[model samples]
Every structure is written in C-alpha cells, then in structure tokens.
Target: MTDQQSKLLKGKQILVTGGAGFIGSNLCEVLLNQHVKVVCLDNFSTGKRINIEPFLQNQNFKLVEGDIRHLEDCKKACLNIDYVLHEAALGSVPRSINDPITTNDVNVSGFLNMLVAARDAGVKRFVYAASSSTYGDHEALPKVEDTIGKPLSPYAITKYVNELYADIFHTTYNFDTIGLRYFNVFGKRQDPNGAYAAVIPKFVQQFIDHESPIINGDGSYSRDFTYIANVVQMNINALTTENKDALNTVYNVAYGDRTTLLELATLLKTYLSEFDASIKTIEIKHRENRVGDIPHSLASIEKAKRLLDYNPQYNISAGLKEAVVWYWEHLK
Candidate 1:
C-alpha cells in the first residue's frame, strides 16, 4: 500500500457523492489512504453508514447526510471541494424497469444538480461514474467509446445522458471533466442484501450460506467484470492528468477480458466454498432472461491505456479471489 501511495492525491479535497455504496465506499477508503481530504455525501438510499464507519475518526474524512436530488444538499456538499467523483445513481436495470421515474429523478436530475453545484464550487475537475450499459443493444463484442446503441433501459439512458451532459459542461461552461465508463464492477463492500444486488456479491453470499445460487438465462451471459482497485487507479489518473487530450474525454475502465455467467458462478462457488466443503456441492436454479438485460458486454480499454495510462492490476480470477475472501470473512 505504501509503494502505491507515491501518487498520493496529497493536497486535493475530493467530494464523493454516494460514498457509502460498494464502489463509493471502496473509493473513499482508497482516497483516504492516499492522504486526500474526502467529503462523502450520502442520503443512505442504497448506501450504508457502516461502510464509512471506520473513517469517522480520521480528520481527513467528513460525512454529510444529504440527497443529490436536492440542490441545497448538493451545494452544501461541494463547498470547498477541489474535485468531484460523482458515483450517486440507482444502478440496477431491472429496478429501473420497475420504477423508471425514480431512476430518472435520482440519476438524471440528481446528477445535473451535482454538476451545477460542482461548477458553482469552482472545482478543478469533475470525474464521474459512467456505465458500460450505455452500449445497450449494440451487439458488439467489445464496446468502443464512439459507438453506442439506443438505451435498452431507463438506467442505461440515465448513464448515457451523464456522458452527454459532461461533454456539454466541458464545451459550454468550460468545466474540465472526465468520465470513466465502468464495465461490470464487483468487489468488496458490494451489498448482498438487496433485490438489486450485483451478481458477484449475491452469488458469493449465497454460496457461503449454502443456498443455491440462481443463474439467469442458462448462465450463458458474459461480462467484462472489473475490480474496484483498477477503477480507483483510473479515477486517480483522471483527477491528476493535465494532458490536453485526456480532459473532457470518456475512457473505458475495465479489465479488457470477459467471462460467462456459468464460468463466474463456478469460480465464486469454488473460491468461497473452500472455507466449508458443504458449500461446494450447491446447485444452481435457472431463471427466465431478465428484461432490458444484454446477453454480453465487453469494453475496448485501449483508449484508457493510451490516454489515462491505466494499467489494471487484477484480472477476473485475481479479483474474484480477493472478493470471495472478503465476503467470506465479513459477510459471514
């Protein structure tokens, strides 16, 4: 950790919206470790306070209970913030399909409010969480930044809109911004309690608890699952890079590899079930394909490699090992 701390975001004040969710919490910890002063704004919609509890006593860290949908909340959170790592959003495609208005309100309107607040706060940079789902219905093997299909779900539309707005902010208001188009991100702190929980954490918890994990659409679907550490590195690079080409551009933050669902389940069960042999023999129940769900998704990360200087440290197998171990110890 100390060796990696050389690129410490030492003098920066970063405001991480939704800083208590899985990815957000992990990002907060990483920033704090790098000696950054972090202001975490969360309304606890999907984020849990427990995730930020460890950093409460750290002078470099401050927590604000607030909603991004409210302009006042955003204004207050962005006060004196040097950079904004915007991660607040309603994430699940199925959930968005079930309640699109709420997704649009929180993701679209809430995101705009944050952007306005960040602009008003005089922040130097705006780094946001963009999604690979923006490539919805493209039917491509590895998605590139320039090509995207019409959004297949409300969630996808909201994320794509985020990129569009970020671009507008750069050209219209001269707001220097960068976007990291995240693929299937899964690692520690990803909540396994909700109906909309991500597949990796949900599967790990079920395997640990000796419950049969469910596989949707015969488990043939594939994804380019990215680890949180790689994402944190990308964010750090985006925040610091003074390269003229990198600013105001979107880059894919991913492992540049793909894995099928059956392959993923086997890896999770085998890795997690090592703690207890009984979990090794668990069965999987097949379910109907989910609505607004893409069969396969991948990212062409060469742009990030060339511009962001992003070198991902963990591939799918390495990432799963750490994630499984974390869930086994913490979630148990």
Candidate 2:
C-alpha cells in the first residue's frame, strides 16, 4: 500500500463479502494491515474457515458468518460499512454447469442483494469481483471493457449479470461501483484441495505429492494469469480513488501477459523442483478441453492503468515462484 492509500484506508470500515475465500482473505489481510476496520461476511459454503483464521485475532477484523443470498444478512453486514469488496460467488464453470440454479442464486441474486444493501446503507463505493469470462466467445485478444461477447456458460452469465446489476445500481440508485474482471488469480493461502481448485495450486500440490498434473487439452490454451497482490492493489485503488471518472465502471485486473498451460506446468515443475527434485520427473498428462472454456484469454489492463493508476508488480514467472514456495511449505 502506498502512503496515500494507507492514509485513505486508515480508520475506514470496509466489508468483504467473501472474506474467507482466497481473494477476499487476501484483501482482508491487506486492509487489516493498513489498520482499516474490516467486516467479513461469508456463509462458509465455498469459503474456508482456515483462510480467515489469522484475522480472527486482529482487533481491526470482524467476521460476520452470513450468506449473501439472504437480503437480511447483506443488510446486516453492510451496517456502518464505508465500502464493499464483494467477492462472494460460485466460481467454477463446471460447478455452475452442474447446478446453474444455485450459481444464479449466489452469483446473481446474492450480488443484487449486496448492491441493494450497499446502496441502502450509503456505502462510499462497491468494488466487486467480475471475471474475464465475461469476454466470452469474443475471440479477442487483450480484452477491453466496452466490448463483451455472449456468455459461454452459466458461470459467465452470472458474472456478466453482476456487472449489469452494478451498472444499474449506479444509474438507478446513484450508487458508486467498480467491477474488476479478474484474470486467473493465484497466490498464497489459495485452496488447492477442492474439486474446483485453481490450476496453479492444484498442479503445485500434485507436483509436491509426486503426481502427474493433468492439462485439459494439448496445453496450447493460455491465460493472462494474474497475481493476487495485483488484484488487491486494484481493489484498493477502486475503493480509495477520488476521481469520479473511475467509478461506476469495470476494469480488467490482470498482469497484462499470457502463458500457456504447458508453459505454466513447466514453470511450476521447474520452481517446485527446487524443493523436491523428483518433481522434475513428474509427467504432465492431457485430456479433452472442458466445456465452456475459451481457447485463450489475454487482458488489456490499459483501462485500469489509465483510470486507477494500476501497475502490476508480478508477472507469471515471479508469481509462480512465490506461489510454489508457499505451497511447498504448507501443502507439502
């Protein structure tokens, strides 16, 4: 956090709706470090208790164990809150494919509940977790904010709906909001055990266990894999920026580069090999690409850079090195 950011966030009350999940917990940790009072609202469905365990002891942190699907819970969490970093949603495409109704309930309806709650409470700003998936089927490189294609899956639909609701909130209720369409984010404390675990952490844990990590396709598919710290920076900027032009819109929060699955698995193997040399011998397997997956995703972070002064510090290699080290120490 910059000196200005510290000063801006200091003593302010922020509510993180998914504060026990990977990205939300990271945001909570950063805000708490800046001496900001943080209220975390999560039902523990997809979020883990252990993720927010460290913050339980922090005087500046408070956990509100509640579901966002319920309007009452959203209202309760938003009480006296200055800003809302809404990260709660069912994230996986496969999970949504299996159960679109539940995904809609949480991602769409829950998101609307948060927006209404924030607007009613007169929260200063609402910064939310959008997805690069919203650029669905556009076949565009370096995705920009204005142009978006049809949603490819139920999960994508829910996320795009979030952006729609945010825009409506801004126009109809005069509520200020910013949506961050995050690329593939990874970092410390991210869960690697679940069935819907992210690629990097899952592969890292597999390598640590001397198991072959499976690539969904021939490994040519790529993503603008972003680091969590970059995302946190974007959220903080969105929350603290005084520029009126920066509000009531969305930004692609990314590291502005792409990496292939093969390259990513190779990088993980190389990094993890430092901790366990045997990991170098672990073969990477392959299968048909899953449904609702785009072939490639790269982000043009120029909008966030111009609007929010966003400058991501970690590229793929640097972030993978750091993530591998953490997984080695913890998951191993």
Candidate 3:
C-alpha cells in the first residue's frame, strides 16, 4: 500500500462488493493489510470463493454473501460502511451480446441499487469499476475519459450507463462517487477457467497445458493491459483523495502503455517457459475478431496522476513476469 493510502484507509470501515471476485478480492486484501475493517459482499455468480478463502480468518474481514442486484442486499452491505468500492457487475462484451438483459440488470440496475444504498447510508465515497469498453467505436489511439463515442455492445451500454447514473447521483443527491475506467486488467487470483475469462489468464492456462492459444484477430489488436496492483492502487486513491476536482468524475486506470496481442502471447510464452520448457513450443493461433471487438485500445492516465496522485508501479513486462510466476506456483 502507498503512504497516502495507509493514512486515509487505516481503521476505516469499507464495503467491497464482488469481494470474492478477482479485483474485489485484491482490494479486500490490501485494505485488510492496512488494518481497515472490510465487509465483503459477493453473489458468487462469476466470483470464486477460493479467491477470498484466505481472508475468511482475518478478524477485520467480514463476508456477506448477497447479490448487488437486490436493493436489500445492497443496503445491508452498506450498513456502517465508511466507503464503498463497487465492483459487482457482469463483464465481457461477448457475454453481453449473448444475454443483454441479464447484463443490463446486473450492471445498470445493480449499480443503481448500490449508489442509492450508499447515498442513504451516508458513505463517504463510492468508487466503481468502469471499463475501457465504454470507448466503443471511437477510433482514438489513447482514450481520454471525457471524449467517449457511442457504445457498440450491450456490455458497453451498461457500463456507460453506470457513469451516467453516478453523475446524476452526485448532481441530484450530492452523493460522492468516482469511476475508474479500467483497461485489460490481469494478475494474481484472476480466474483462468471461465468462458469469459480475460486473455492473459486464459492464455497462461493454455500454455501451461501445452495447448495452442487463439488470438481473436491477426494479433495486431492492442490493449493497455493493466496490472491488478495498479488497479488496487487506483481504487484506494479514488477512495482516499481529498481533491474536490477528482470527485464525481471518471479517470482511466491503466499502465499508460499498450501491447499488441502477438507481443502479449510471445511474452506469456517466454515467461511460462521458465517454469516448463515445453511451453516454448506451444503454438499461438489466430481467429477472426469477434463482434464488437475494438481493433485497438489505450488510455491517457494523466487525469489520475494529476488529481489522485496515481503512480502505476508495473508495466506489462514487470506485471506479466509476476503474474506468470504466481500462475506457475498456484495453478501448475
């Protein structure tokens, strides 16, 4: 944890929705390390209990198994919470393309529920997990937060709606909120066994099994590829920042760098080969880019730096090396 983060969060009570999921669990871990009281709310739809199992024994960590889609559950989770880190939402554009209704219900309606509950509970801050998918069809290279294009996927629409609702909550009800529009986040405890799993974990798992990992396009598509620790830092910064200018606004949470799909695959292969040399021979395949897939995406994190004092510690190479080692030790 950073020095400023420790000063702001220590001994405070926090609610982390989706705390059994990858990003949420990491937030819980860091908050607990700061000696902050943590209440974890998760439905386990996509979240795995194993991700949070280690924290179960910590006295500062409390678990509330509930869905964010339920207003009652949201209210219950927000009780006595000093801050709310809302991360409970259905992810993946492809999954949303298959079932838009469920995605909308959880991402939009559920987000509203948390906002209302937090507002009523008088929570100090509500920091949420937004997405780079909100950039949609905009052909910009490095995405800026204020200039967004029309949403192209159901998932994008839902996430974009979250920003809208958050703004309203601030303007109308004076509820404080911050949205972190994350790029391709990957690291320890991220699920590698789902149909909608992010590329890094999925590819790492495949290479560990000596199977060919498929790229969604000709491998030219690129992403910001943020590390989980950097994301945790952003959430903490958002929750802790006293800058009035940073409140009720969205900032891009990324490494300020981009990596092509081919480059990502090669790096993963090289790192994993350190554990098992056979991984060096694993073939990387290619496929047609899926519908609603952005050809390229990156982020300008200058806003976060200026307002939240956000300093991302890991680039792709440094983060990938750490992630590869964790997967080898835990999954292999």
Candidate 4:
C-alpha cells in the first residue's frame, strides 16, 4: 500500500460488496493488510467462495453472504460502514445480452439499493466498479471521461445508468460518490472457468492446458488491459482523495496503454512457456467477433492523475509477468 492510502484508510471500516469476487477480494485483502476493518458482502452467483476463504479467519475481515439485488441485503451490509466499495454487478456483454432482465436486476436495481442504503447510513464515500463499456460506439483513440457515445449492449446501458444515478445521488441527496471506469482488468483470483470470463485468464488457462485459445476477431481488437493492482490503487485513491475537485465525479482506472489480442496471446504464450516449454507450441485460433464487440479501447487517465493524484504502477508487460506466475502456481 502507498503511504497516502495507509494514512487515509488505516482505521476506517469498509464495506466491499462482491468481496468474494476478483477485484473485490483483492480489495478486501489489501484493506485487511492495512489494519482496516472490512465487511464483505457476496451472493456467490459468479463469485467463488474460495477466492475469499483465506480471509474468513482474519479478525479484521468479516464476510456477509447475501445478494445485492435485495434492499435488505444492501442495508445489512451498509450498517456502521465508513465507506462502500460497490463492485457487485453482472458483467460481460454476452451475458447481459442473453439475460438482460437479470443483468438489470443486479446491476441497476442492486446499485440503486446500495446508493439508498449508503445514503441512509451516511457513509463518507461510495466508490463503484464502472466500466469502459460505457464508451460504447465512440470511435476515439483514447477515451476521456465526459465524452461517450450511445451504449451498444444491455450491459453498457446498465453501467451508464449507474453513472447517471450516482450523479443524481450527489445532487439530490448530497451523497459523496466516485465512479472508476475500468478497462479490461485482469490478475490473480480472476475466474477463468466461465463462458463470460475475460480474455487474459481464459487464454492463460487454455495455454497452460496446451489447448488452442480462440480469439474473437482477427486478433486486431485491442484494449487497455489494466492490471488488478492498478485497479486496487485507483479504488483506494478514489476512497481517500481529499481534493474537493475529485469528489462526485468519475475517473478512468487503467494503465493508460492498449494491447492487441494477437499481441496479448503471444505474450501469454511466451510467459507460460517458461513454466512448460510445450505451451510454446499451443496454437491460437481466430473466429468472428462476437456481437456488440468494440474494435479498440484506450483510456486517457489524465483526469485520475489530475484529480486523485493517481499513478499506475504496472503496464501490460509487467502486470502480465506477475499474473502469469500466479496462474501457473495456482491453476497449474
């Protein structure tokens, strides 16, 4: 943890919704290490209990098994919490496309419940897991905060609605909130087992198994593939920033760099080959790009830097090296 983060969150009580999930579990681990009290709320729908099982015994870490779709559950999790890290949401465009209603119930309604609960509980700050999917059809090189095009998928719509609702909460109820628009975040504990799993972990697992990893497109599609640690840093920064200009706004949480699918695959293959030389022979296949897929994504993280004093420590290569080691040790 950074000195600033330690100073701000040392003794505070924090509530991490979806704490059994990838990003949430990472946050809980960091907070516990910082000697802060952490309350974790998870439904385990997409989150695995194993991700948080190690922290269950930590006295500073408390787990509350519940769904975010319920108001009572949101209220129960918010009780006596100093801050809220709202990361519980049904992610993936394909998943949302398949079942928009369920996605809406979890991402939209659940988010509203969290906001209302946080308002009533008088939490100091509410930082949430917003998405780069909110960028939608905007054909820009580097996405900025204020500029956004129409949402292409139900998932994108739900995340955009979150930003709208968050702004309203601050204006109407004077609640403090920060939205961190994340790019393609990946790292340890990120589940690669599901159909809706992100590319990095999924591809890494396939390579480790010496199976052909399929690329959705011609492998030209690119993204600002952020490291999980950088994301954790952004969340901590959002929660702790004392700058008045930083409050009640959103910031792009990313490494401010992009990598193509082909490049990513090659990198993963190269990294994994160190563990098993056979992985170097793994073939990569290409297929049609899925519906609602964007061709390229990059983030201009200037807003985060200016407002929150954000400094991302890992670029793609550095983060990928660490992630590869974790996946090898755990998944292999």
Candidate 5:
C-alpha cells in the first residue's frame, strides 16, 4: 500500500469511468488527493450525484456526463488521459437475472468501448472492477485465478468476460490494462438506499433505522468481504507498476479471509447496539436463497502479493466497524 502511496500521480491526467459510483467516487477522491488532474464520467444509472458533489470545487477535477455504452462518449472521456480506471457497470445478480440485455449492454459492450477509446487515446493503463463472483460455481475454498468455474449469473459472466477481453486487448492492441477481481467491498460513500445496494451498507442502514436485517439461506454462505481502501491500492499499484508482467493480468483484491452472512449481521448488530442495544434483539428473516447466489467464496491473494505487491490493511471485522460508523453518520 505504501508503495502505491509513495509514487505520487502528481499532474497526471486521469480518467475514472463510473467516477460517481461508490468505488469509483472513492478512487477519484484518492487520485485527486495525489494531485492528478481527474476526468470523471458517469451516466447515473446506479451512480449518485452526491458522491462527486464534494469534488466540484476542485480545479483539478472534471466530471463528464457520459455513458460507456456510447462509443462517442467513451472517446470524449478518454481525451489526453494518462490512465483509465473503468468502474462503471450494471451490477447485482438479481438485477442481472431480471434483465441481462441491459447488463450486457453496460458491462460487456460498454467495457469494449472503453478499451478501444483508451487504446486510441494512448492512455497509460486501464484498470477495471472485476468481481469475486467470477469464481462462480468453482466450489473452491479459496478461489485462485486461472481456475474459474462456469459463471452462473449474467453479472458473473460479465466480469469473467471482462478478464477475457482484457487479455485479448493486451495481445491484440498491445494496450496496458489490469483487472482487479474485488471481493465484497464496503466502505464510506457506499449508497445504501438502492434496490441492489451491497450487504454491509444495506444492513447498516436498516439497523440504523431500527429495521430488521434479513439473512438469506440460514446465512451459512461466506465471502471475503474487502474494503474500498484495498481496492484503491490495487488500482494505484497497477497504474504505476511500470512492469510488463504486471500489465494485462488480473488479481483478486481482497483480505484473504472469509465471513458468513450470519457472522456479518451479528457483527453489525453488535456494533450498532453500542449506541442503542434495541437493534441487537432484532430477529433476522431467512428467505429462499436468491437465485444465482454462491454458497461460499474466499480469495487467495498470493498473485496480488507477487504481481502487484498488494497488502490489504483492513480485515472484514475492522472494515465493517468503520463502515457502519460512516453509514450511521452519513446516511442519517
């Protein structure tokens, strides 16, 4: 992490697609802090204005109202950019199951457009948000790259396709790109009001509002819930590595630990109960496990450690504690 921080991106022209989304906004904030001139692009499909509102005053930051699905918009956003941190996409397994065409439009076609634009514009590197769900039905205790199972949902298929396309772009066009397969990432600025909001933010908001936090399938399923900071580190590291072997590769960005949903809810309840113990007694409801859901997922960070020098600072417990406080303070 320090390696990324030590090499400042001062005065570099950077374009962060999906810069208004949860992870995207966080990445933009970090890049701006490093004194980079940032161009942010988002169509607001799932991204929010509030995420980028604070940066409006920064002279070094620019926000473009554009969609990646539109090749012209991507072309315009990529002008004179040193790097592209592509984070825009239609996420959520349930949402993808409900409507796959839209997911394909945004996640697949949109990504292709960005690659072409970046390569054409001579961008230094392209880093994107991949998913742990790419492990799909592998049934492995700790998922490793290059051994993915068949993707079950449209969303997982989209992410897996992203890695494939990225490799093709590298060999075909010789453009530098990296894909970070993020585990469940939660942190500040994560929107909790959306229909497909992530687990941590959604539960935190519900508990704060004195509502019940629901668990699916008896809550035995687990994930390597990662924090936003670790992802930020990976993007920065990938962008700066100046190593040929690091380019055109994908790495799992996670804490390398696992926690079941039951454990997550209990932790949230316990933490929030500190302010008001009433939420602790709230019973959890178990619905039929959602379709396209995996039973368990943990990641092996050996590749990231070797290639990107990635070191995660926040484990799930420490991350959730900090994230819950942010949601309570920010969402309220």
Candidate 6:
C-alpha cells in the first residue's frame, strides 16, 4: 500500500462478510496489518473458523457469527462500517446444479440483504465478489465488463443477479459500489479436500499423495487462474480509490493471462516434484466434460487499471510456485 492509500484506510472501520473464507480472511489480514478496524461476519457455513482464528486476538478485529441471508445479521455487521467487502457467496457450478435453491438463497437473496443493510447503514463503498462465470458462453477470448452472455449454471445466475442488484442499488438509492468479477483464484488456505475444491490446490494435493488427479475434460480447457494476492490487491484498490468514476461499476479482476488445464497440471507436477520426485511420474486421468462449464476463460483488466490504477504483481508460475510451497509446508 502506498502512503496515500495507507492514510486513506488507516483507521477506518471495514466490514468483511464471509471473513472466514479463503479470500475474505486474506483481506482481513491485510487490513489489520494497516491498523484498520475490521468486522468479520460469517455463519461458518462454508467458511472455516480456523481461517479467521488468528485474527480473533487482534484488538481491531471483531467477528460476528451471522448469516447474510438474515437481514438483521447484515444490518448489524454494517453498523459503523465505512466500507463493505462482500465476499460471502456459495460458489461452484456443480454444487449449484446439485442444490440451486440453497445457492440462490445464499447468493442472490443474501446479496440483496447485504446491499439493503449497507445502503441503510450509510456505508461509503460496497465492493463485492463477482465471478468470471458471469461471462458464460460468451466465446470471447478476453472478457470485457460490458459484454456478458447467458448464465450457464445456478451459481452463474446468482452472480449475474448480484451485478444487477448492485447496479439497481446504485441507481435507485445512489449507493456507491464496485463489483470484481474474479477468475479462478487460488493460493494458501484454499481448501483442497472438498468435491468442489478449486483445481490447482486439489491437483497439488493429489500429486502429493501420488494419486491421479482427474481432469474434467481432455485438459484443453483454460482459465485466467488468478492468484489470491492479485485478488486482494484489486479489492483494496476498489475499497480505497477516490476516483468518482471508479464507483458504481464492475471490473474484471484477473492476471490478464490464460493457462490450459494440461499446462496447469504439468506445471503442478513439475512444482511438486521438487518436494517429492514420485509426483512427476503420477499419471493424469481425464473424464467427460462437466455440465455448465465453459471451454475457456480470460479477462481484460484494462478497465481496472485505468479506473482503479490496479497493477497485479504475480502471474501464474510465480503464484503457483508460492502456493505449492505453502501446501507442502502445511498440508504435508
């Protein structure tokens, strides 16, 4: 953070809903490092307590055990909060296909609840966790903010609804907001055990165990595969930017590059081999493509660069090497 940006957020009270999740907890850590007061609200549904356990002892960090689906919980968390980094959402296409009702309830309805609460509480800025899935079926190489295709899954629908609600909130109530459509974010603390776990970490773990990690398709599908640090930087930029034009719009938050699944798997195997030579020999398996999945995803981060002065520091290889090291240390 620059001196000017640090001064902008020095002592401000910020609310991070879903602060116990992967991206949220990382945000909380950064804010606390800057001596900002952070209020974390989570129901421990998808969020793990261990994620935010270290922050429990910080004098400036407050944890509110609550759900965003409930209006009262949203309102309470917004009180005296200068900014809201809304990262709470039910993610994953397959999970949404299996149980879309709960996904809608938590993502769409819960997002509305957060917006209402933040607007009513007079929060300055409401920055949220949007998704690259919103660009579903667009068939575009690098996705721009304005152009989007039909949602491919319940999860995508909920995320698109979030963008709609945010725009409406800004137009109707004059609420200042920014939505970050994140690409395949991964890093330390990203859970690798679940059925819906992200590809990078899951593959890393499987390689460590010398197990064949199944590729959903023929491994040709690619992704932007953003790092958690890059994501955290974008959120901080959205929260602290003084540019008036930067508000009330969405931006694609990504590394501005793409990596194929086979390339990604090969990279993982190579990185993991430094720790365990056997991992390099582990065969990679393939299966039929899953439903609601797009063949490729890339993002144009120029809007963010021009508006928020965003500059991502880590690319795929640099970020993956670091993530692999973390998993080796902790999950080994």
TM-score per prediction, in order, is 0.97, 0.99, 0.99, 0.99, 0.97, 0.99
Instruction: Residues 1-332, candidate 2: write the lDDT tens digits.
Output: 89998998877899999999999999999998888999999999989999999889998889999999999999999999999999999999989999999999999999999998998998989999999999999997889899999989999999998999999888888899999999999999888987888999999989988899999999999999998989999999999998899999999999999999999999999999988888889999999999999999999999999989999999999888887778888998
lDDT of 4 by residue, 43-126 (tens): 999899999988888999988889888999999999999999999999999999999999999999999999999999989999
By summed lDDT, which 10 consecutive residues of candidate 1 come out lowest? Answer: 1-10
Q: Candidate 1 lDDT, tens digit per residue, 22-41?
A: 88899899888777899999
Question: What are the runs in model 3 whose C-alpha is more than 4 Å off?
Answer: none
Off by over 4 Å in 4: none
Q: For model 1, give the RMSD to the true fold.
A: 1.5
Candidate 6: deviation at residue 70, Å?
Answer: 0.6
Query: In candidate 5, which residue pairs clash?
Result: none
Model 3 error, position 119 (Å):
0.6
lDDT string for model 3 (47-121, tens) is 899999999999999999999889999999999999999999999999999999999999999999999999999
RMSD of each: 1.5, 0.7, 0.8, 0.8, 1.3, 0.7
TM-score computed on alpha carbons, candidate 1? 0.97
Q: Provide the overall lDDT of each model, using Cα atoms, as 2-decimal numbers.
A: 0.90, 0.93, 0.93, 0.94, 0.89, 0.94
**Clashing pairs in model 1?**
none
Error of 6 at 277 (Å): 1.3
What tens-digit string does per-residue lDDT give for candidate 5 at 201-312?
8888888888888887899989899988888988888888867888888899999999999999999889888877788788877777888999998999999999888888
Candidates 1 and 2 compared: the better one by TM-score is 2
Candidate with the larger lDDT of 4 and 5: 4
